[model samples]
Target chain A: EAGVAQSPRYKIIEKRQSVAFWCNPISGHATLYWYQQILGQGPKLLIQFQNNGVVDDSQLPKDRFSAERLKGVDSTLKIQPAKLEDSAVYLCASSSGLVFSYEQYFGPGTRLTVT
Target chain B: AQTVTQSQPEMSVQEAETVTLSCTYDTSESDYYLFWYKQPPSRQMILVIRQEAYKQQNATENRFSVNFQKAAKSFSLKISDSQLGDAAMYFCIWGANTPLVFGKGTRLSVIA
Candidate 1:
């Protein structure tokens, strides 16, 4: 079975510039998630989508970051006026069932470097 | 709120040897789950093992096993017969019905 897929394995943008990352979840998976992983830290959930509907996005910085899962299959995360602190890897994951019952499969994250 | 902690920032093990990485978590919910995920330099997060809070039997998969102490809220991963490919950043995660909370992560290095 194919795993989660992401685009532009690496990206670099100037501070204050805008950047976007794309994710395509595994076929048939109902839950999708976007996470940000800073250097030397674990990945933190930026947002979660349950079939195109947001499940949780409390940790997301609304002022600069936004994400959407259109049609419940492909998702996109965008950051406007990116800050140097926003330089990190953005990971996309998908699970078939509730997290407690099913394991999540992650994609090779897109590394965003804001200069 | 649930939190996961990995005190050991880094650890090294000789190839073919064994190593154990420690993790502790706090959660008020009784129906939660614990997980160990491995992230290699290639940047892919892979699920290593998972343990349910109510299960008494420790979860094991091949050379990977978890020592889970529900009462202590401690979950540690033990990798036996370690191989070079086992070197990666390991994260401990806590999850209930909500989004997962991840620890800072422990970097494991296998020396040949």
Candidate 2:
């Protein structure tokens, strides 16, 4: 089976510029997630969607970060007027959503460098 | 909010040796999941192993195994007969009704 796919494996942008990352989940997967992984840290969930409907996004920064899972299959995460601290790997992951299951297939991630 | 902690920032072990990475979490929920994920230099997140809260027996996958102590909220990963390819950043995660809360990760180095 094909794993989760993400576009722009690497991105470099200046602070205050805008950048967006895209993700295509595995076929038939119902849950999608966006995570931010700073250096030396694990991926932190920025948002989660259960078939285009947000399941959780409390950790998302509303002022500069936004994400949407249109049609419940492909998702996009955007950061406008980025900051230096925003430089990190933006990882997208998907899962089957079965009960008692925590297996999530993750993409290679888009490495964002904000200068 | 639930939190995961990996006390060891980095660990090193010679090839064919064994090493354990420590993790501790704080949560109030009774039902949850614990996961150990490996991210190599390629940056792909790979599932090493997972343990369910209700399961008494530790989850093992080949050379990877987890020691899950629910009462103490401690979960650790042991890599047996380690290989140089096992070098990666190992993340301990706590899965709840919401998203998975990750620890600061432990970077493991395998010297050949």
Candidate 3:
């Protein structure tokens, strides 16, 4: 089985610019997640989707960050008018069942740098 | 709200030796799960071990084992026969009905 795949392993953008990251989860996985990991810190959940529908995004900064999983297989996370504080690694993960009950496979994260 | 804490920022162990990484969590849920994830410099997070709250026996996988103390709300990982491949950032996580919460992570280094 293939693992979760993410695009553009590294990205650099200027402040106030817009950037987007893509994620293609493992086939047959029902749950997908996006997390942000700042340097020296663990990944923090940004959004979670169960199939095509969203399960939780309370921590997401709706004002500038948005994500969507249109077909339930692939997802994209976007940040518009990015801030310097947004420079961090964005990780995508998928699980066949609820995270607490099943193992989640993570993809090689996209490291974003805002100038 | 659930929170995971890794007090140690970094630790080093000699090859073929043993080392323990400490973690403590705060959660009100009676039943939940705890996990240790390893992220090498490659940036992919891998599951090292997992422990269920209701289980009495601590979870162990090969040379990796977890000492889960429910009463103290502590979960620590013990790596035996440490190898250079074990060098990475180790994160402690708390999982319940809600989303998983992660610790700051401990960077482990193995000396040859």
Candidate 4:
């Protein structure tokens, strides 16, 4: 019954720094997702994981953005050498990963600021 | 690739009034899912409603309902008897054969 949980509700770092965020999906959830939301924009999927394996990462900035969902329940998203453009909210979500339509439960996103 | 568009960047409505938010998306898949999410200042994304492409009848939840025009690629959210709590940024999203994609979003303001 618990919702998706995220750590480090807020973070501030300078350009060229590195930042990491953690997420704990709901119990028994098989799919995890990380998204980035810039001001005045909608959230964009950075990566998706199905039980510890990546389902999609085509939109991810592979050079700088990396995410892993180890053990299939918890996920971590990292941004190395964070750029000013990377200043946004990092959102974690999870779903049933079933064939039918399932809603994703979102966490109180981590707000990251890169100066 | 799938793309979502929310042409109205902002809208305002008085309390107890009704408002509609427009959304459109492009997709090649015949069966997929469309959703509307609301994000308030607290920064948590909340699901408002969803529509399935395979279903012809529209979906409704309490005071929230959707007008799904599959051929026109239009999905709109209509909130009846809007309240101040309805003030937030609404995002239109779709996931076809690919991953989910969200639109720029429309900010709604409720004037008491």
If both were scored by TM-score, which would come out higher, candidate 1 or candidate 3?
A: 3
- The residue-level lDDT of candidate 2 at B25 comes to 100
Candidate 4: chain B TM-score equals 0.96
- Regions of candidate 1 where Cα sits further than 4 Å from its true position: none
The candidate maximizing TM-score is 3
Across A1-115, the per-residue lDDT of candidate 2 in tens digits comes to: 9999999999999999999999999999998989999987788889988898988899999999999988889999999989999999999999987432658899999999999
Q: How many residue pairs clash in each candidate at the backbone level?
A: 0, 0, 0, 0
Task: Please report, in order, the local distance difference test score of every candidate based on alpha carbons.
Answer: 0.92, 0.91, 0.94, 0.90
Per-residue lDDT tens digits for candidate 3, residues A1-115, read 8888999899999999999999999999999999999998888889999999999998899999999999888999999989999999999999999655688899999999999
lDDT of 4 at B52: 86
Residue B42, candidate 2: C-alpha displacement in angstroms: 1.7
Name the lDDT value of residue B44 in candidate 1: 78
Chain A accuracy as TM-score for every candidate: 0.97, 0.96, 0.97, 0.96
**What TM-score would every model get versus the actual structure?**
0.97, 0.95, 0.98, 0.95
The collision pairs in model 2 are: none
lDDT of 4 by residue, A12-115 (tens): 99999999999999999998889898988898878888899888899999999888887778989999989999999999999886532588889999999999
- For model 3, what is the alpha-carbon lDDT of residue B52? 90
Candidate 1 on A52-107: residue-level lDDT in tens? 99989999999999999999999999999899999999999999984535899999
**Residue B45 local lDDT, model 2:** 88
Report the number of the highest-lDDT candidate: 3
Tens-digit per-residue lDDT, B1-112, candidate 3? 7889999999999999999999999988899989999998886899999999999999999999999999999999999999999999999999886478899999999999
DockQ of each: 0.75, 0.67, 0.76, 0.65
